[model samples]
Structures are given as C-alpha cells and as structure tokens.
Target: MAPGLLDRSRTVAPPGWSRWLIPPAALSVHLSIGQAYAWSVFKPALESSLNLSGTASALPFQLGMVMLGLSAAFGGTLVERNGPRWAMTVSLLCFCSGFLLASLGAAVEQYWLVVFGYGFVGGIGLGIGYISPVSTLIKWFPDRPGMATGIAIMGFGGGALIASPWSAQMLESFGSDSGGVATAFLVHGLVYAVFMSLGVLLVRVPAEGWQPPGGKRPQEQQSRKPLVTTANVSARSAVRTPQFWLLWVVLCMNVTAGIGILEKAAPMIGDFFADTSTPVSAAAAAGFVALLSLANMGGRFLWSSTSDVIGRKNMYRCYLGVGGLMYLGIVLLGDSSKPLFIVCAMVIISFYGGGFATVPAYLKDLFGTYEVGAIHGRLLTAWSTAGVLGPLIVNWIADSQEAAGRSGAGLYGLALSIMIGLLAVGFVANELIRPVNPKHHLPEPASAAGQAEGTAGHEGGAEHKEATGR
Candidate 1:
C-alpha cells in the first residue's frame, strides 16, 4: 500500500458542517429567489403602465425563465468546481441587483430595461441558486436523495406563497398610484439582499473525517472508487445518448403542460363557466391560484419521496400517464364542475413539482453524481424551450378566441388538446429511457461494490464505512 497516499486523503473533507443545517441556509436563498414566481402579481401594473397586452406583459417572465435555464446550463460545471457557498453568494448579488435595476427601469418608464434587469440578470440568479445546493445535499444524504431534494425544492414552490402576500403589502405601503410598482421593486431588492447574505455567512463545507452520524464507514478505510468518479459523460455526449434527449423531452413536456394552466389560471377558470347561471368571482379565481400553489409545493416533497420507493422510472410514468389522463378529463368534461377542474389541476401541479424534484435524482441515477450538475444544467435548456412554448400556447389560444368573440370552455379546448399531445410526447420520451452505458460507470473500490447488486437485503449488506458526523 502507498503510505503517503493514505495521509493525503485524510486532509480533505466532504460537503458540509452538518446536513440538517444546510437546508435552512438553502431555504433562505430559495425562498428569496422565489419572488420570480410572484412576477404575476405585477402583471396588472405592467399592463396599465406600459400599455401592453397580456401576451406582451408576460414576455419578461418568459425571458427570465429562458435565462434561468440557459444560465444553469452554462454554469453547472462551474458551480461544481467551486462550492455551494460561493455559487449562492453570487446568486444573491445578481438577484438583488436585478431588483434594484428593475426599480430604476420602472421609475424611468423603460420596459426593455426592466426586462433586461429582471429577465437576464435575475434569471441567472435563479439558475445558479437553484443548482448550488443540489449536489451538496445529495452528497450529504445519498441514501435519501429524493427526500433531500424535496425539502429544498419545496422552498422554491413556497416562495410565491410568501412573496405574493408580502409584495402586495409592500406595493400598498410604498407605492403611489403613479409609481407604486417601482417603489415595491426597490424594497424587494434591499430586503432580499440582507436576508440572503445570512445564508452565505452560515454555509460551510464539512470538516475532514465528517460523515453522517452513523455512516457506513470511514470512507478512506474502504476500497472505494477513485476520489474522482469516471462514469460521467460530457454534456455534449449526454445529449447524444437516447436518455438525455428523452429526459429532456420528458421535462419539457411536463413543465409545458403545467405552466400552461398556471399562466391562465384565473382567466381559464372564469372562462370555463361563463355560460353557467353562476359565474366565478375574482376572489374564487384567486383561491384557485392559491390551491395550485399548495399542490405545487406539497407535490415537491410527496411525489419526489415516492420516487425513492418506486424508482424514478415508475414515478415519471405516474406523471406522464396519469397526468395525461387528468388533462383529458378537463378537456372531455369541460370546466363545468369546480370539483373536476380543481382535482385535475391539483394532480397536474403535483406532478409538475415532482418532475422538478425528481430530475436531479434522476440525473444522479443516469449520469452519476460526478457530473450530474453539468448534466442537469444542460437539461435545463429544455426547460428554457418549454418556458417559451407553454405560455405561447395558452395566451395565443385565449387571445385568438377572445378576438373571435368566444368565451367559456370553448376558448380552452384547443389549448387542452395541445397539452394532451405534449403529454403523449412525454410518455414516449419516458419509455425511451435506458440506463447510461457501463463505459461511463466509474470504477469503484472493491468495498463500494462489495456485495453485488440484489445481494444487499432491505438492510444494506455492508454499511458504508464512512467516518463520524461532521
């Protein structure tokens, strides 16, 4: 045995000071970054001030989403190379700065500048912040990857819950009828900057020899794979594989279906029964939006955890297959019944959040954790694509129908048809997934794979020989 090699390995550490503490820090960043979802709250202001149509007003949010995906794809490898603390700190800066910049743009009455600030700059923050804690969380909780991801992702979903109400109050307090939105933007920037900085200060990578309280082994004591994993494929290579493109299609389709409903929630519900004796009130429509948020947030944890038990494949089948049926129900029956509409919408959103929470774990399954971040970043391109597509399908159909003097469920039939088709495409993509090639499998130490697959019982055959809790 090489004597010096053993000593060198002892010097470095794993990811965090403690896994439990990390989620709080991560939540701080996630919750603040979540204000992006609240952009809709400003929609009426943007429309009235800028004199834009529904479609035009939605452009900034769509651009931000596109930028989010693109920046993540580009920054994924960089985040892995650095660390979560650095990545998230930078995200805080960009996001806060975007708010400040948008405030200036709004005050001066330049919508393009607002778009540039919020969409491009803030979107970068969203992407980097979203991916930063993911790999670290997985390292800390390998056995419960789904659960770990669910906890953090729930913050993303819940962000809107906090922001919508808070932003509404801020607008009332600080805003004059003339420039209330601008003042609200300024306050948002200042507050988030302070809140997110605390997270940056608290984050710390684990000390040397730190492991979960009762991890399998002193990692060094075991014969494990090289410190550097081998089976990871280049992002370029990942796209070429059937798996990458398939999953890309799957994510895109799932997100597109979900976002379509989200973008049109109020109007869609209103249109569903314009023909009815009793029409939906604005308050009821708002309640529907709240319900969707609840489903989205809850699904992030519940459905993703189910993936741990059922496996990623089976879970996604539930997403696409069952999700497809849910959409079909909405289309076939129309939105005549609130019970039916609400049920379908809730199930679809749960799958929507599940799709996001499951992807990182799915990436770990296929690409190996070595380059999962990079692969994840690349896959976000599909999200960027869907961000554009989803809103377009919804708004375009609704606008076209409105122009033709149509109302009620008739306005949504075409959009539902499109959503059904997307789910079908996703079903095909899900079926196409296969494990990554063994060539990409990094060589592991004898102890790591000691008990061959299936040999390990419900209780793992040999616990990891990792060290004490850091």
Candidate 2:
C-alpha cells in the first residue's frame, strides 16, 4: 500500500527545497486559529440573544483558553511522534468543526452545545495548531531559530487584527440575533476550513541531516554559546530540570503582567483619564485598545528577531527588567501626562508579546531540537495559568478599590505595582536558568546509521522501518 497522506514520511521536503516556504504554511494555521482572541466580538450577541449574563457569555472563551493549555500539554508528545502534517490535519478538523458545531448549537438555542463545541472541541485545535510549526521551523532554520519562530507566531497575534473586524462586520450585516450568530459561525467555519487546508498541503519536514546553506551548523553555533546545548533532552527529562521550572516561572510572571493590562485595556484607559482636564472619550479609548493590539503584534516579530542578535537571555532581561520599569513609569507619571501613559503602556504590552514569541527559541537553545515541539506544548501550561491569574489579580484589585470609593488612575495603582513585582520575580527566574546536566541528555548513538534511526523515531517512525525494510 502507498504511504498514508498525513503520515510524517509523506511530508518530507524534496532535496534543495527552500525553507522560506515554511513560514507561510505555519502562518495559515496560526492566523486561522488566532480567531480565539476575537471571541469578545461574539460575546455581546451571545449574551443578548441567549439572555445570559456577561460572565455567562464569557464561559466559552475562558474554557477555550483553559483547554488550549490542557490539550497542548497532554497532546504534545503525540504531535512530535506524528509530525506536523498529522498534527495540523488534526488541528484543522477540530478547529473548523468547532465552529460548525457551535453554529448548530446557536441555531437550536442550546447554549451548552456552543460551550462544548467551541470551547472544548475547538480549543484542542488551538493547542495543537499553536505548536505545530514550532519544531519544524526551528529544525529548518537552526541558523536563525528566533527569527523563524517569530515570523510564524506573529501571525497568531495579528490574527485578532483580521478576525475582530471581520467578525464585527459579519455581526452587523447578519443582524446580531440568534439566527445571525448561527450564520456568522457557519461562515467562519467554512472560510477557516479552506484557509487552514493550505497549511496542510504546503507544510513539509526537512530531509534528515539537512542543514541551512552557507550557515554554521547547530553544533558549530553551540560551541560559542555556553547555554546552547548539542545534546538532546526528551520531554520527560526537560520538565524535571530546575531550568524548565525557572523558565516556567519566567513565562508565567511575564504573561501575568502583560495580560492583566490587556484584559482591561479600554476600561483602564478611560478610568485613568476620567477626571483629567481632557477626559478620554469612548472612541478614543477604543482607539487606545487598537494601538495596544498593534504594539502587541509588532513586538512579537521585532523583539524575537532581535533576540537572534542580542541572545535570548539578554532579550528576556529587557522583557522583564525594562518591562517592570515601564509599569513603574505608568504608576508614577500616568496621571500627569496622557502621552507618557500611552507610551509606557504600549512598551509594556510589547514586552508581553515579545515574551511569548521568544520563549520557543530560548527552549531550543537550552534543549536540543529532538523533542522541542513536545517541550513547547508542555511549556504552554504557563500561558493557561497566567490567563486566569492575570485577569483575576487586576479585576479583584479594581473591584476592591471601587468599593473603597477610589476612582480614576488611583483605582489601578495597586495592580500596576503588583505587576512590577511579578516582573521582578520573572527577571530573577530568567537569571537562574543554567545549562541542563549531561545526565539528562539522550545517550549518543554508536554509528551514523543508528543516529539516523534514532532521529527518524522522533521525526517520522515509518521512515526508518521503510529504509531498513523491516
């Protein structure tokens, strides 16, 4: 029988294929799944049509985020074993079908279906798709892992840019009622299904022993950087290391600091200027949120690429160290000057986005690429934890302040201070990271053919069996 279509062996790149094609393939799936960020666009319509409260309508988005972490953590090893082709196919089916199932739920007026379909089913797609391109791109462009992963991940941040307006316009044209919501969901499912198919068709794994043309080999590069290891660490070994948990704390703290502000951007801005000489209007507040989104998206690519030059450790120093200072600037001078406040907030948000884009390359530097994708999936548990922690801290503080008759910028002073502390903690954690122990490295194979077989086991199990006529 011919090889299966989604099998890892089937997706190997031809000799002399350009690696540049990989980013667009990764972008297709990322951009499609990034629609999760635009969940807010549907929240109002869901609340009004279903006659549910604000918090009730938020259940799907919150649950989706929770599941994104869970599925990525649990399914990461399967992704590595199966290859990007299999993983991407699984992602496409789950993500698109989620919308279709959710559309049906809305049409029948059963809210639970929407929650299950969109939150549970669709979130698996988000988790798997999110990490699908990470290892492939890293292996293809070991010369510039930071820039390569940055290019694909930037699409995730920008996805909200395309999705938010598109969703809003659809709701406007289709009338925002239960029927219109169903139609909108249906359209989203169909459109994304087609778009994500491009990724499945175009994605390919580098041929075994492939190296970038005219670039230093990964071993050569690792010789100069003490932190960059040549030995591979399995996903199981990675989590047990102190380095892994340290990076986890680094990611969690950085994400918490940034996401707290993001979750409350519009309202936070309005309150900051509520009693100023020129109070911010609703339109201006909305514009501020847009500007923050642009900053977030732009920073992912720019800062990650910069990490290629400055080194990952130094890049994170800027993220957590300078990020904390930015928060302090806002707390100290925000009320006195509007321009200063906006600029500071933008910088802080940019660092937040940068933290996400840069961490994969950092992981690759610390752990060899052997199981980096699975390691990445495991690392995303931090994102899930921060998702809840960040918002809870900010919202809880704001509520307490409000009860005590605080208003304006004063309402956020304590929250901003708390963010600074978190960044400090992250900065320390980043500093604590060191090289993994040799005890944890996968033992070196005795021969070249044996090494190739070992790699094939992780890259594509069937390839080795076929090569050996097993």
Could you say which candidate leads in lDDT?
A: 2
RMSD of candidates 1 onward, in order: 8.0, 3.0
Please count the clashing residue pairs in each candidate, in the order shown: 16, 0
Off by over 4 Å in 2: 219-223, 446-470
User: Candidate 1 — which residues are off by over 4 angstroms?
Assistant: 1-16, 46-59, 107-112, 177-180, 206-231, 234-236, 334-336, 398-407, 442-470
lDDT of 1: 0.75
TM-scores for all predictions: 0.83, 0.95
For residue 96, model 1's alpha carbon misses the true position, in angstroms, by: 0.8
Per-residue accuracy of model 2 over 1-470 as CA lDDT, tens digit each: 88898876788888878888999999999999999999999999999998989988988888888888988999988887788888899999999999999999999999999999999999999999999999889888888888899988899998889999999999999988999999999999999999999999998888768777886665326448877877777787899999899999999999999998998999998998888889999999999999999999888999999988788999999999999999999999998899999999999999999999999999988887777888999999999989889999999999999999999998999999999999999999999989999887765541232223223545433344345443
Cα lDDT of model 2 overall?
A: 0.88
Judging by TM-score against the true structure, name the best candidate.
Answer: 2
